[model samples]
Target chain A: MLDHNAAAARIFTAALIVIGDEILSGRTHDKNIAQVATWLQVQGIRLKEVRVVADEEPAIVEAVNTLRARNDYLFTTGGIGPTHDDITVDAIAAALGVGVEVHPAARAILEDYYATRGGLTEARLRMARVPAGADLIPNRFTGAPGIRWGNIYIMAGVPSITAGMLEALTGTLEGGAPLLSETIGCWVGESEVADLLRQTEKTHEGCQIGSYPFWREGRTGANFVIRSVDPDRLAACCAALAAGLTAGGRTPVAGGL
Target chain B: MLDHNAAAARIFTAALIVIGDEILSGRTHDKNIAQVATWLQVQGIRLKEVRVVADEEPAIVEAVNTLRARNDYLFTTGGIGPTHDDITVDAIAAALGVGVEVHPAARAILEDYYATRGGLTEARLRMARVPAGADLIPNRFTGAPGIRWGNIYIMAGVPSITAGMLEALTGTLEGGAPLLSETIGCWVGESEVADLLRQTEKTHEGCQIGSYPFWREGRTGANFVIRSVDPDRLAACCAALAAGLTAGGRTPVAGGL
Candidate 1:
């Protein structure tokens, strides 16, 4: 396990690789992007970028290598299951230049799990396979555990199973202070306050302000999300931004419209 | 407009670039990925890849250049709004090596739109700005239209507005035959039928079969999706797949389980 307190000074960032032909084909709407991103944020690690690629081997290998090399951590969801098409393990193993073998602990777990349900057939045993030197991320929902190999975590495509893996991973990986954000909504065009947002962000170091405009109920409004590592600084920035909106004759709504 | 029928012999592919810091921060759940991918499929274009980047100019520019250079078409959603943070236009212009200009027709639309609501203020007029030599994709919901420059499309981040822009673009871009797919579900583990899928796909040229496994009600099941450009071939392939699954002692469910 990484030291959370020792890594407090450095900001940890992660990249997510969504691997599935179903997603690219639009047959499946991905819930993992939001789920993983939200989970990583609470772990105090920023999800910097996400790439959705087809289940092809070359695409998966390229994405895993590129993303895992660049970010502090890389998470992959999908293509790890009891199927020939589920080849994320093989692809990632190839990318890492390691041969895949069935982990004994995982095999035992799956054996015990399927003992009463059904005998462990060859197909069911495929779930025990993992890349060399990989550890397991426990999945309470299913017997097939997630793979964690040197900052690269491979999770299941199923939303429920992925949730279980994430639940077991809580407080295991090291991370810095979680980012805090406050949203101020105003019934005004975001362009109208472009300078104010930029100036406010400039005035506060280590803060980013994002303006999201919307047209709803025959009216235009924008939600300004102010984010910072420090909660006090985030609150102060939100207050300043709200003051700026009020000075411009627009009432700022707490939360968002 | 590109002639869709003329490009029937070639395969057209597209890449999507999702721009927003809110998405990375987990503040916003992206609805555009599936929407754009589905729309592209209807246009006979395969959505090959998607990259989610922050609201930064260089990141947007890099993604635009990389994806546009590789794919037949590139679609970008978000960051093109009446706000200072909306720098997609500037980034795309920089990538295309063109100057940013106030499109006269776009300006006219915004002027007429704001005439009854509020006079076109400086901030509102910002919507008229686009990369030089870009055409507009009309927005029925909002006056600020989407942009089309060469093979790149700049669309609104908001899902509704993006839908409007995609609606306007229907049948305009040239593409090959739209890919057709059929789903067959079986109450058996995917690995049990891995060789069946592989052999089925191998027998049917131009067809790809993807296996997605699920665990429900204490039983395992899998959905096999077969995709092909030829409808007759796709139907034939599905028949073979269903026959194979039945041979393996699994009842095939139509339209998936």
Candidate 2:
């Protein structure tokens, strides 16, 4: 089990499994990881790792097993379609030792969804496939629903569907309070004040310190982003950092992260 | 062993390690994974996984070991600066069971890099420190340089630097032919043709099919992208797919993946 004793700062690690042959072939530029990573951070969750794998059964099964065993929450996007390549549902079902078929509730959603246009046929009815003992996640856009099995929440490959499901699912699930970040960006080359920067980092015990160097117009400088669960602590660390850099002769302006 | 010997098709996997705390704080949106994935893919290399970790020794060391063991190649970004968070060199050395300090060639790169800038202090000279027995990767942007350790290539976290390092390293590595992809954007919803799509997938053994449903301007449709290492096979699969969808009364458009 992961260490969850500390309420002060418990890192919420997430593993993003981007399942699609399109991504592997460079057909689809994955927008899920970046957007999800940003969202997780806002929710005080740390996105530890991300995986992009082909729409193959063995590959998906192996990736899910590996990532699920390691992280706290596993959010998977893609392969939950009605087409031939949409095998994520089956793979996930097999991985959990569950049977996959059309669940009544999920079928109800698809049946209602298809009735308006074309009555549910074999091609369209495939959207109702759900693993045993799983709950259906309503799709506000289309009638075909998604399922939530164990800790794995499967969403549509399209960004809209994925985001819609996450909005609902994320609300129902518990999450740590959001993390706040502070950054100081100014013109001080890393090489010019390497000694003082090292000292400031040593002084700050728990806060995370990162130096980002940028070249704009010709001047070079590093941006120090200090992040912590506590906003007060972050501000305090930044103050000390600015004072430290100033006392060492360089003028630093701060804001970011 | 990863058991790649008898694979029916050429499959390659990679993991990205971002050794900086700025990412966790949302200060810098990482672009390395997307760019590198695109590059590796052009040469038929698959990027499987990625990890954005802090500069903490234990975290970096643990991540390097786990990722390297799972994938064929591991590309690391950030944490090779002249500052204190620049402990990637030492942490990697510790993970590899080797002692680390300033290797001569790495030190030379730093010396030359500093000579153009003006002077190299002991602090600035810290950028030269690299793990022992690492082959140096030439840095076209700045001279502090990156190193290649076994299958793992340690690179700059900065977007431009990492990209430059990747280009120089690409020609030096052995890779397979490029992967080809094809996409068919259909004006029909996924739920309308999911079942037939599954059957089409079951029939085609040589190609991978992915259907992505998108909503634009009150119209909802699915974009199906098929992928494979073989170009002729991919074209053949898409051809059959067009016929199958047409038979189902849904018109599928043809395009690039």
What's the true lDDT of residue B102 in model 1? 96
Worst 10 residues of 2 chain B by lDDT: B1-10
DockQ of all predictions against the true structure, Cα-based: 0.65, 0.44
What TM-score would you give candidate 1 relative to the actual structure? 0.94
For candidate 2, give the docking quality class from DockQ.
Answer: acceptable
Predictions in order: lDDT? 0.89, 0.75
Weakest 10 consecutive residues of candidate 2 chain A by summed lDDT = A1-10
Residue by residue across B1-257, what tens digits does model 2's lDDT show? 34442352657777778777666545567677677878888756777666667677887888799889987888899988787778888899898888777768877777887786867788777777777778888887878789888888999888888888988877666565556777888887776667666667677776666777777778877777776777778878888889988888878788721
How many residue-pair clashes does candidate 2 contain? 8
Per-residue lDDT of B30 in model 2: 69
lDDT per residue as tens, model 2, A69-150: 8777787888776666678889988887789888888877777877777787776666788778888887897766767877
Model 2: residue A45 alpha-carbon error in angstroms = 3.0
State every prediction's TM-score relative to the real structure.
Answer: 0.94, 0.87
